[model samples]
Target: DAGVTQSPTHLIKTRGQQVTLRCSPKSGHDTVSWYQQALGQGPQFIFQYYEEEERQRGNFPDRFSGHQFPNYSSELNVNALLLGDSALYLCASSQMLAGGDEQYFGPGTRLTVT
Candidate 1:
């Protein structure tokens, strides 16, 4: 299996700009999770998608949004981008097991806002 994959490997955006990143989950995975990782910081949970619905979200502003497709793929959309929004956007895929969710992360898309 391909584990997880992200697109546009790298990205650069200006302040107040809008950007979107894509992700494909591993085989047989139904849930997708998005995270933001700033330099020297741990990944911060952004949101999660299940059955194409936004199951959970983080403290990010409204500018940060996302969508999950029927094929189990996902996208992270950020509007009115800010300098503070520059970070490594990570995508994780996993299934909701009884024990817990063991997420597998993608390489991530680096978004830089000038």
Candidate 2:
């Protein structure tokens, strides 16, 4: 089965610009969650989507937002990105509802905001 995949394995951007990252969940999975991983830090949950609606979110700012589609794919959009936004953006998938089970992650889309 095809697992979760993210685009632009790596990315570079300016501090004030915006960026959008995409993800496709693993087959048979229905939920998608987005995470941000800074250097030497663990993945921090940004938000989660289920039934095409945002089900849960973490302590991120309003600049961090996401969307889920009917096909179970997802996207992460950051507005007025800051240098601190530079990190590995990971997308994880799960078969159950929010926090009900373990999630499988993608390789990640590395974003470098200068």
Q: Write the per-residue lDDT of candidate 1 for residues 1-114, one digit (tens) a residue.
A: 789999989999999899999999999888999999999999999999988999999988889899999999999999999999989999999986632268899999999999
Instruction: Tell me the lDDT of candidate 2.
Output: 0.94
Best by lDDT: 2
- Candidate 2: C-alpha RMSD after superposition: 1.4
| Error in Å for residue 88 of model 2 | 0.3
Q: Which ten contiguous residues of candidate 2 have the minimum total lDDT?
A: 95-104
Give a tens-digit lDDT track for model 2, residues 1-114: 888999979999998899999999998889999999999999999999988999999999999999999999999999998999999999999987454498889999999999
lDDT of 1 at 58: 93
